[model samples]
Every structure is written in structure tokens, then in C-alpha cells.
Target: MNKVIRIFIKDSTLIPVISIVLGLLIGALIMLLGAYNPIRAYASLIEKAFGDLYSIGETIRQITPLIFTGLSVAFAFRIGLFNIGAEGQFIIGSVTAAFVGIQFDLPWYIHVPFAVVAGGIAGGLWGSLAGLLKVYRGVHEVIATIMLNWIALYLSNYIVKFFLIEPGQQRSRILSDSSWLSSSWLSQLFDGARIHYGILLGLICTFLFYVILWKTRQGYELRAVGYNPDASEYAGIHVKKNIVRSMMVSGVFAGLGGASEVLGVFHYQTIHSVFPGHGFEGIAVALLGGNTAVGTILGAVLFGVLTFGATGMKFGAGVPIEIINIVIALVIFFVAASGLVKAIIDKVKKKIISGGSSLPTSQDWKKGV
Candidate 1:
């Protein structure tokens, strides 16, 4: 039992699970204080997310982009890079996809892939700029990415407004049917939900992420650089090139997310005055997932349920949507503070182990039992 307890406490996966439970409990307490029924609210949230086919489909739709963005962040972390500019990369990809989908007329087999690839290439190039700055000019990735996010926002808007805008609309023109990733059968199965092939693509990317990181020579080099750049350089690895390559690959994941949203869900790109928030949310997903490929998918699912269920909580249980936001924020906080949680778990485990084999007490010594 003591051994089992120690193993459980030492498992890194326990942290996020505990964090999620704590967040939910705190949220329930908050709801009680606000004179709302937490159980009912949660029930409604679940029902809204998975009660029926339509809800399940939409929930999956919500999860798809997060999977890609989470993979993007997780992939970068494996190479010791902070890809804060996933938002910018995603935007570039979306606009580039929209442009390709609109400009070209081709068969469905060719057109869909062409547009997706265009988006990925655009995002990769955009992300590589930060890598270039870091390698050549000695700028920090965080700073470069932060600046690039704003540039991407404005640049994407310009491309939409000037090149692809629908007349009298604030969004780009719709892609041709050939470029649409939607399957009529799938849509009908989900009762007309906007779910598409994006989720499948995200799963494929997750597999690739795992394969490229753990099973390939390039992945070994990237991990080596991440573990110790000086040693890797001493061992004849091209540290600078790896940095650029890491960023490019990370950007491809985010870019694919953007392209998927345009090609599969919305079928058009909107010129936003602000970010769509997927990139930022992805940071949380990556953190909660411990930057692992499978963990990322799980994290995305948790977030997807919480996000899509917020509406149900509001309409079904009369809970304010702000409460859900607070709950999510608390989850992020707990995840960020996982070191403290681990320490607490460690202390408990130590107590349990020590108690099982503790020295005799003074009374026991005197009695000589």
C-alpha cells in the first residue's frame, strides 16, 4: 500500500488530474456562495456537450483546433522553444488558405490539399521569422513572437480586405465546394452540425508528432538540443538550424489548425479586430497535457467540454457564463502551481510510508512490548 501510494504521488499525470478536480470543487463552492446549484449546473453542462448527436458533433468541432494548437505548443516545448506566436501563425495560415481556395479552380482531390498546404507553408514561413531573429539577431523568441502576433493580425486583415473580401462583408469570400472538407454524410449523421474532417487530420498530426519526436533522428537531434544546446553543438549538431526547423514545424501544426477551421468549419475567414483565442487557449492545453501528444488530445477534450458546455450551463441552469470562465481560469492556475501540489502529495506519501514503519513510541519502550 505504501509503495502504491508513493508511485501514485510520483506520477506526473496526477498533478493535472488533481488540478482539474480542485478547480471543479472550487467552482462548485463559488456557485453555492452565489446561491446556485452546482450539481445542476454541471449536469446541464454535460448534457449540452454530449447529450445528443448534435452536441457531440459540435463538441468535437471545438476540440479539433485545440488539438492542432496544443500539438504546436507541445512540439515547440520539446525543442525548448516558446511559440507564443501561434496566433499569428494560425492567422497567416487561415488567410493563405482562403486565398488559395478562392484563386484556384481544381478538382476536389487537388484543391483541398493545395489550400491546406498553402496555409501550412505560409504559417511555417511566418514562424521561421522568429527563429531567424533568435538565431541571427539574438532576440528572444517571446518578444519576436509577441510582435509577430500583432503583425499577423493586421497583415491577415489586409489580405482579407484587399484580396479575398466578399463585397460589403467583413469576411473573405467562401471557398469553392471542391476545397470544403465537409462530408455530407457526416453532417447528416450529426444532425447538420459543422463537424468535418479536421478532427481526423488533428489525430493524424498527433501521431506524426509522436513519431517525429520519439522515433526519428531529427527528433533525437531536436531533443538533444533542447536538453543541452552547448553539448549538442559540441557534438556537431547545428543548433541554429534546429531552432529554425523547430519553429517551422511548430508553425505547421498551428497553420494546419487555422486551415482546418477555414476549410472545414467556417468555410471562410473572418477579418477579426482581435484574436480568436485558440492560440492562447492552446498554451493552457499544452501545459495541462505535460506537452505530450496523447496528453494534448485529452487536455483539448476537457477544454472542449468546458467551453461548449458553458452555453448549456447558462440556458439550462441559469448559471452565468462568467462562472465557467472563472472555473477555467482556476484550472489554469492549479496547473501552473502543480509544483506545490506535487510537494503536498510528496509530504503525504512520506507520512504514510513513515507511519507504516515508524520507531516505537516512548510508552512502547517503557512497556517493552
Candidate 2:
């Protein structure tokens, strides 16, 4: 039993799972304090998220963009950078995709790919601006990214207003059908749940993220730079270039997410006074996922379920949806404080080992047979 406990404690994957469990338990406690039945609330959440085909399809849709943004943040973290500007990149990508989708007249094969790629490129460029600022002007990426996020937001709204707006609407013109990523068959199957091909793209990107980070020479250099920049520089790696490239790549993931939202779900872009929050949520996903491709997907699924099911708690159990937000915040807090949890576990392990292996005292020796 001691050996089993030690082994379980050593497994890093268990940390996130434990954090989630702790968060849920604390949330339940809070609910009880508020005179709410957490069990029924959670049951309603699950039922709303997965009860029928339509619910499942919508949940998957929610998961799809999260997968992209999670990958974006995770990829940046692997390179020792914080990409706080994914919101900006996403906006740029969406606007770029909208432009292409509205302006281009081509077959579905060409239009779809073109519009998506355009969005990615635009986002990549937008993200690289921060990298460039960091490398050349000595600006920290966090500050640069935060500033860039506002710029991207305002710029996107301007573009919508001047070039793409549909007459009196605050949204851009609808994309041409050729550029749409929606699947008629899938929609029908899900009973008009608005499912699309973007989820498939998200899965493909996850696989690519794994391959690029684990199986490529460039990945090695990026990881090396992240581990020790001076050592990487001494080893002939161009750290500056890699930094810029990493940010660009990170932006591409976010941009693709934005494009997916436009082309697959909404088919139009809205002028927003504030961020859509996907990028910020992505940070949470990345942390929960431990910055791995598969982990990000799982984290995205968890977040999707929680977010989509918040409505169920509201309507079925008469619990305030704000409680779910509190639960999510608690989850993040637990994840962030995982080092303390590890310390506690280590203390227990030491006590167990010490108790099991204490030297026999003089009294014990005299009493021995």
C-alpha cells in the first residue's frame, strides 16, 4: 500500500485529476452551504451536455475552438513564452477569413482552403509583431501581447465597419457558401445542432502539434531554446528567430480557431467591443492539460461540458450559473497551487516511510525474544 501510494503520487497526470476532484468537492460544499443540492445540479449538467444528439453535437462544437486555442497557448508555453494575445490573433484570423470568404468566388475546394490559410497567415503576422518587439525593442511578451490584443480588437471592428459590414448590421456580410465548413449531413444527423468540419481540423491540428513538438528537429531547437537560451545560442540555435517563429505558430493555432468559428458556425463576423473570451479560456485549458496535445483535447472537453451545462444548472436545479464560474476558478486555483499539494503528499510519504523503518530503541531490544 505504501509503494502504491508513492507510485500514484509520483505520477504527474494525477495532479490535474486530483485538482479537478478537489474543485468539484469544494463546489459541492459551497452548494450545500447555499442550500442547493449539488448532486441534482451536477446530474442536470451532465444530462444537458450529453442527453441527446443535439446536446452532444453542441458540446463538441464548444470543444472545437477550445482545442485550437488550448493548442495555441500550450505551444507557446512549450517554447517558454506566454501568448496573452491569442484573443487578438483570433480576431485577426476571423476578419481575414471573412474578407476572403466574402471577396473570393471559387469552388468549395479552393475557397475553403484559401480562406482558412489567409486567416492563419494574418494571425501569424499579428502574433509575430509581439515576438519582434520582444526580440528587438526589449519589450516583454506579456506587455506586448496585452497591447496587441486591444489593437487587434479595434482594428477588427474597423474592418467590419468599413469593408465587410452588411448595411445596418454590426456584423460582417455572410460568407459565400463555397467557403463554409459546415456539414449538411452532420447537421441533420444531430438534428440541426450546427456541427461542422472544424472539429476534424482541430483534431488534425492536435496530431500535428504532437508530431511537430516531439518528432522534428525544429521542435528540438525550440525546446532547447526554452530550456536554456544561452546554451541554445552557444549550440548555434538562432533563439531570436525561433522566438518569432514560435509566436507565429502559436498565432496560427488561434487564428485557425477564429476562422473555424466564422466559417463553420456563425458564417459571419461580429464587431465586438470586447474579446470573445476563447483565448483567455484557452490559458486555463492549457494549464489543466499540462501543455500537451492530447491533454489539451481532454481539457477542452471538460471545459466544454461545464460551460455548455451551466444552463442546465440554471434551469433545472435553480442554481445560479455564477456558481459554475466559481467552480472553474477553484479548479484553476487548485491547479496553480499544485506544488503545495505535492509538498503535503511528500510529507505524508516521509511519515509513512519513517514510521515503517524506525530503529528499535533500547527498551524494544530488551523486550525482543
Question: How many residue pairs clash in each candidate at the backbone level?
Answer: 0, 0
lDDT for position 62 in model 1: 95
Query: Ten-residue segment with the worst summed lDDT in candidate 2?
Result: 360-369
Clash pairs of candidate 2?
none
| Residue 357, candidate 2: C-alpha displacement in angstroms | 9.0
Angstrom error at residue 105, model 1: 1.6
How do the residues 298-350 of candidate 2 rate in per-residue lDDT, one tens digit apiece?
99999989988889998878889888778888888878887665555556557
Residues 1-369, model 1: lDDT tens digits: 487775443345767888888889999999999899999999999999999999999999999999988998888888899999888898888889888988889999999999989988888898899999999999999999999999999999998999898999999998998998887888899998889998999999999999999999999999999999999999999999999999999999999999988999988889898999788878888988989998999999999899899899998879897887788788889888766666665666567666555433333323631
TM-scores, each model vs. reference: 0.92, 0.91
Question: Looking at model 1, how many pairs of residues clash?
Answer: 0
Give each prediction's root-mean-square deviation over alpha carbons: 5.9, 6.3
lDDT of 2 at 266: 96
Error of 1 at 42 (Å): 1.1
Q: After superposition, how far is residue 189 of candidate 2 from its true place, in Å?
A: 2.5
Estimate the overall C-alpha local distance difference test score of candidate 2. 0.88
